[model samples]
Target: MGMKVGIIGCGSITKFRHAPEYRANPHVDEIVFFDRNLQRAKELAQQFGGRSVETIEELFNDPTIVAVSDCSSNEAHHINTAQALLHGKHVLCEKPLAISVKHAEEILKAQAASGKKLMVDHNQRFTKAHQKAKEIIDKKELGEVLTFKSSFGHQGPESWGVDKSNATWFFKKERSHSGVAGDLGIHKIDLIHFLLDDEIEDVHAFYAALDKVDENGKPIEVCDNVVCALKTKKGRLGTASFSWTYYGSEDNSTTIYCQKGILKIYHHPEHQLIVETKDGAVIKYELEPIQTNENQTSSGVIDAFIDCIIHDKEPSVTGQQALASLKVIEKILGENGI
Candidate 1:
């Protein structure tokens, strides 16, 4: 049976991921949109042959929306997601479920009361290389993972944001909230958590605004770069860095060093996943190219969220898991006293 869905934002994420993926999914029959900017919602509705709703209540009251994708800005996630869940709609929220763990928990409370699904768009977990790496680790093919390094960076949000202007909310600490730490760092934090099947127990981080400038030619208000060292609950150690200053090729890669072998992911274009054993044997597994800011690809997140609703299963990236990752990011951003 086809289901109707609502999307809470018409920004880049909605434009690049949610809207198109919903339109493509055979299970989805309708796409209703609501944005602070009514024009953006109307435009997307027109482009996708959907409908633009002026208010969130209008979308929620429709009663036909089985699920909603909360693609709003970072600061708005908690409110929008909680309201949607309370309205009995399964919600797939964007990364950093909330600016704080407290807010995230509130959303979770709403989810519990509503008994609706809550998924976060931690799409790295759905990547082929990452999934393969997890499988290898689970089989103990790499033995105990000892140390690791993972990074996610690009030419900054101005280059990727819908407006393609420096004034994008990502540079504003108020709206962006945690800057690159929440925008990019949380994704890696969540990825590490998934790959390790653990939570970050310790953190030491440093972040700053290095290169990005605002429309007034002043340095962006929020940190554009971040570097951190983290330790997982199970004692796995790693270093992570997130940046909006990688003007070169976007780098989204992780190298895991295990007792028996090393797993290198997205380090090579041809061999996206490579394993190097302690005994000098090396193996390479080729997969699809890593999705970058410039190269748009199926995140698999939207599909998974819809499937979960249809199958009456829990979300693939649950709100609690996202809260765990967000807590690590809060520590990195020096929130909650670290």
Candidate 2:
């Protein structure tokens, strides 16, 4: 039976990634969209060959919706996802699960009570390079992963958001809460967690609103840059930086130093994964280029979500997994006085 899906927000994420991906999924028969701005929902519905519902309650009450994608802002994820789960619909929430760890737990609790699946769109985990890297690491090719550094940065969301305006919700503290840290850093944190199969233990961070400015040329209220020193539960140490002021090409790169070798990810244009062994051998694996706002790629996230629902398997990026990353983010923000 074909499944019907609901999208909770008609924001950039919904327009660029989730809505299109779901429309392409064979298992998804229909899509219903709901947004605070009814016009936005109607526009996405028209563009994606779906229908717009006036209210979230209306969308959730529909018996046909088997699952929902909570593509709302960081602050709305908890409420939207929890309500969906309560309505007996599986939820695939976007990154940073929530602005706070407490909110993330609330969604998890709702999922537990409803006995429904709750997935998170930490899309980095589904990338070809990261998948291949995980396989190599699991085979002991790296010989005891020791330490790592990862970063995710770009020009800024102003150029990437749907409206392409500095006045977007991303710049607002109430909506986004933790600027670049929550926007880009959290992805790397999730990537490290996925690759090493470990959780972060402690974090010391420095964050500030470095460069981005509003129409009045005032600095943005939220941090535009964040750099953090991190330690894993297994005692491996690392550093990470998230920024909206790269002012150059996107740099979503990571390097893992192990006992026998160093694994460089996204370090080269042609080679997505590079290994330099202590024995002085170099191995390079060319993989697909990373997806950006302009250069779209199949994230494999929506497909995975659909397949998991159809086959009754657990999603690769579960709510519980995301909660761990959120906790680390909370610790970082707490330390930095965010």
Q: Which parts of model 1 have CA positions greater than 4 angstroms off?
A: 336-338
Instruction: Report, for every candidate in turn, its global Cα lDDT versus the true structure.
Output: 0.91, 0.91
- TM-score on alpha carbons, each prediction: 0.98, 0.98
lDDT of 1 at 208: 88
Residue range 6-39, candidate 2, lDDT tens digits = 9998988899899889989998988999999999
lDDT of 1: 0.91
How far residue 87's Cα lies from its native spot in candidate 1, in Å, is: 0.6
User: How good is model 1 by TM-score?
Assistant: 0.98
lDDT for residue 295 in candidate 1, whole number 0-100: 85
